[model samples]
Target: MENSINVSSEVGTLKRLLIHSPDSGLGKVVPSKAQDWLFEDIVHLDTMRRHEYDYYVKTLLYFLDTEKIKGKLNEIDGDESRNFYKPDHPDYFNSEKVIELQKLLADILEDNLTKMKLIAAICAIEHEWYTTHDELLSLSPNELAKTLISGTTPGNEMLFPPIPNFIFTRDIGITINNHLLLNKPAKLARTREALLSQYIFYNHPMFAEIRKNLIEIPDNETLFLLPEEEAESNQSTLEGGDVMMVAKNHLLIGISERTSIYAAKQVIKVLFEKKVLDKITLIKIPKKRDYMHIDTVFTQVKRNMWVILGTLAKPHSESEDEVLIRSGLLKSKKSEKVHLVQFRRGQENEPRVIESLEELLTEISVYDLNCSPLEVQFIYSGNNEFPFGAREQWTDSCNLLAIKEGVVIGYDRNDKTLEAFKEAGFEAVKVADLLQDFEAGRRSPETIQNTFILLPSAELSRARGGSHCMSMPIFRENFE
Candidate 1:
């Protein structure tokens, strides 16, 4: 059997994680195209590639596989080898298959040397990206990986913008309680992430046996299409950043600027049908770039403790609640306004409406969490102030990556938020300090507890993502 995923809690000990190295994609962005790709400012490709992302990759390699698959290009390069193997042979493929593979390589690859090297590397991974049966078996694995990371397309003369956000792999898809939810990205800039992630989960040999258990959302476009139709503005669109697993049987999905309420309903419907989720909590935040996804403003860092934005941590007033009710944003038993039509198999049932968002969540937790009551102590970003809190949040003060029950990582520039964590009993330790301790043989990561290991923020923070935004945990032990 292949390695399986089992993430049940945010703070569980992380065993396996998925990450993407920064590539030529970052260089593809120019000043005029920066904002369109969700970049706040243009970045120097050399600085981004050489400095900012190196430590992040080093940190992840400490916990996950870091080896590169070497290929056999020299032996397989000649036209004779390409034309030799047939379907009946163990190696799989014949002359026609080799021709198609050669054509594909020529269309996407710029030089003969790079094309041969990539083909060799792909041969090592033993997977194929094909248009047909013979074609699939003919191409090598290195070619597929190169195509995914380099943003090259077959038959397209014009180069597309490399997906720089691909470095932030956390936004693509999420594994919830052993089931992989292949998400549909809300932006064209991030569509490649979804496709590549699904390909890895479904076709990679590492997940070959466990692929049967994955539940990929079927509506997303997998292949790039030029002059594509505009996505229905009102239709459902989901992103992994908006989904959170709060408990073993409980999930919290944000219906915010990036994720639509329709998207939340679609995910909720699938969860209910699978019987894996007992209750689903939907949080509605302001629709804006600053609060694009829930993880940007909210994440659980430890048991009974969450990092949240100051404005959202506060409860609503009676008058404010009443206004929401009247506006049809908040429903009640007296006014059961229907907005979502629930579907089972191919049949549709009566519309599902909530009495009140807060009420629904509170009532559900009362049973699922038992007497502990699922009370989460929130540590808000900055103090209770206007622009100060907003400024800190914009820099990702609330985006924290939880390594284990008590260890977490975030940007060091968020001083105010770091102080808040210190006040809440989490000791603040700089990455330099932690690295020094390990180097001197005084301590290792396992020996640290209830500590916030701060990472340098000069370049990474400028990209508008913290540690949590960059990593996607694949296997976390159950905390309970």
Candidate 2:
């Protein structure tokens, strides 16, 4: 709904965040349709919801209220309305249209009949039963989402496969330093993701002071693909999950499935014009099932070290692959061209020039390129299968969250990938409670509303994805 290209630095600290709670949608992901709905298996909606929510509550409790982290946020003002940046808040998150109508309905017919009639109309899309004689569903989404233990159908549409994954928070968008880049979701079903994000940028009182609130920023006619509103074309397309902030100036974009190069070019054009970026290197990875987005394969944990799910940085097959190499530190620390070195794999572990992070940075002239071992490294799910390639399929290594300096969060499945972080001087912590694993197909969520990751399945089979695919971080804690 709102496209504001606000990204500049990678070390910028995260001040406020928007999150959506897993809602009634979790109840709809039936085991029968889990495959088409993108789930491995159905989960016990209630228990799964609890596991997922606690993960966020625990993390936030450690940050938002803590004096150390609170003081670090650049913004000092704490306005409840600013919490538009927080989607879990019902005032900004629930369908405003529905709420508005409900209020009007209540004013006219403030009886049980009115309440029941109103709820039935709102949930006509889904058949919901009225437990209270009062008619109106009294439980907040968080309450229903948290208390739910098991269900055949997901009550909330946004929380299921196509939508439930939004809770991961790492997939939707990211912050390169202090700048925030809003992710453009690819599906209409997830279009509400943009709506949800807009609310977070608008209503959340705590996040009211954020600089990139799309709703409040001066609307730029130049940024809109269809400024006329009536213009139509099959060409307008973009998804936040396909983009990643590789460095302060570098972004690894995937042109596949949801987003295309045309959209990538448009976004790049906007960022370039805004002086938001100095360089843009598009890495067109294979558009296979395993390669959904950049998050599926690679992520930068420390300053120099990176965790790659696929062999994009390595060799793929018997043929020799060539990659473009650039210098990020050359000319100057603020060199216009980002240094990107392509690793060529010749058959098997063939020796290549500039091997290792040390050589990679030195050759690029990043003399002071410094990043201590990260506190933790997470993958999409808990899949520990290494260079086995399935790591690219099952475990999404691309979904990474740099919450603070050297502190990151991600799926807990990449057991060995965690080793990759430690090898780079990080203390990798594995966490697996963020997603709803299903029994049919393997899909991960890159978006997280507030702290909820939406997925269709209440169970784990092979259909649904984990946190990396459900979230997109518009801001982050400093990395370097």
Candidate 3:
């Protein structure tokens, strides 16, 4: 299958995306190493796979490649081995549309030279014994691919720490229109992920045609020469979660916990030079782990609508007295505020200062999308309730993936956020129920509109990401 790469807008009809399922590596996340691996808490691997991620795979397949999963649902579920969900197995539902990262890794490993180079690279970074390279080389492509990701050998011995965060594929790379911008992860735990992704995107046949368009952010030339404190501040680290290709001519880059200001500046300079887009918006959120990426605070539900955390969405009050108090409070706690700046191609010196996230999103709808002001809408996280708003936002209430315009998938545990969606005139349905309707021909993915599909997320939510973070959409029907 030819891999068509294009994603101009967040709410475009998703045609193809990259995803990684929960591997044995997740089960190996002991409490002591959980934080180091970037997981808030350890999760039950079986439950996360069978109950949580499996549903995501099925749903994506149903929407993007219906013939791959439409009638075989029961048969696929009945198998005790669950080979249907295993990328290495013969029965794996290998749909080109709903692409698997592990499967792509294995495909690249099939080449002898690529396998040797990758194994050597891994061993060098991991400080593995020289013999370890030969051992990994001896394994078959499928087994080697599994071991590389899970950090385990065929004998069930751990060779190294697993890349557990690989499940959040969106952090690896992002598709910007016809170009691919790869990530330089901020955390040491994600170094292996970046290396593995570099090899895949550069070496894989699927990305061969678009290799020239791969955008890699280079570090500052004098970064190593700076003082320790200055070097730390100047480090160029970026993740896909911080970048959003919101429209054909517009892009959003967030400076947060995982994406540095230096990196954002580099992106703006490189993209502007390449003429990838006309405008770039820099959203500076607090450098706190709770709001790791901009998508965690908000995401587009449709061309004219957005779901956001109320605290950052807008000012709390319009009354002069309350505004005065808020201004005083903000002066002392400036770090907590969200800052927005917009830069256009020719007018770089006169960048526009956006007041709030709501204002920026409204402008994207009204000006970029050409939607009427009256048609634009906002759904606050936790329905804008006090404690619920903060609590649900932490669980990624605002982080959602739109399968198509006005149709999204989020964690089922976010009840208040679901309520917010309902209040915004969207039908909230559980994934299991929706799958039945799709199977029975009662509803179709194409026919669905103004709906929110909920996924079972008891274990999945512990990983600290929503469907948006789990998906790396490479192809979407362009609104242009």
Tens digits of per-residue lDDT for model 1 on 289-319? 8878888877777665677776565455667
In order, candidate lDDTs are 0.61, 0.41, 0.91
From the highest lDDT down, the ranking of the candidates is 3, 1, 2
Sort the predicted structures by TM-score, highest score first: 3, 1, 2
What is the C-alpha local distance difference test score of candidate 1?
Answer: 0.61
Better candidate by lDDT, 2 or 3: 3
- Best candidate, TM-score: 3
Stretches > 4 Å off in candidate 2: 1-15, 67-162, 170-181, 199-234, 315-387, 419-471, 477-480
* Candidate 2 lDDT tens digits, 1-480: 022233433323433443444544555667776544445565565555444443443344334334322222223123323332223344332322111111222233334443344344434423444442222355443332232211212343232233444454544455544455555655544544444444343433323455553311122344456546433222445555566655565554566666656566666656655665555545555545555565555554445444554334433222222212132212322211112323221211332333332233322224233343332233322233534445434555444544443455555544555544555455443233322221111322222221222222223213244444443444444333
Q: What is the C-alpha lDDT profile of model 3 across 1-480, one tens digit per residue? A: 247898999999999999999999999999999999999999999999998899999999999999999988878777757646778878888888999999999999999999999999999999999899989999999999999999999899999999999999999999998999999999999999899999999999889989999999998899989999898668899998899999999999999998988999899998999999999999999888889999999999999999999888874444633554576634334556789999999888999999999999999999999899999999988898877887898888989999999999999887888887888899999888988899989999889999998999999999999999999999999886
Off by over 4 Å in 1: 63-144, 152-158, 218-233, 318-376
Predicted structure 2, TM vs. truth? 0.56
lDDT of 1 at 49: 44
lDDT of candidate model 3 versus the reference: 0.91
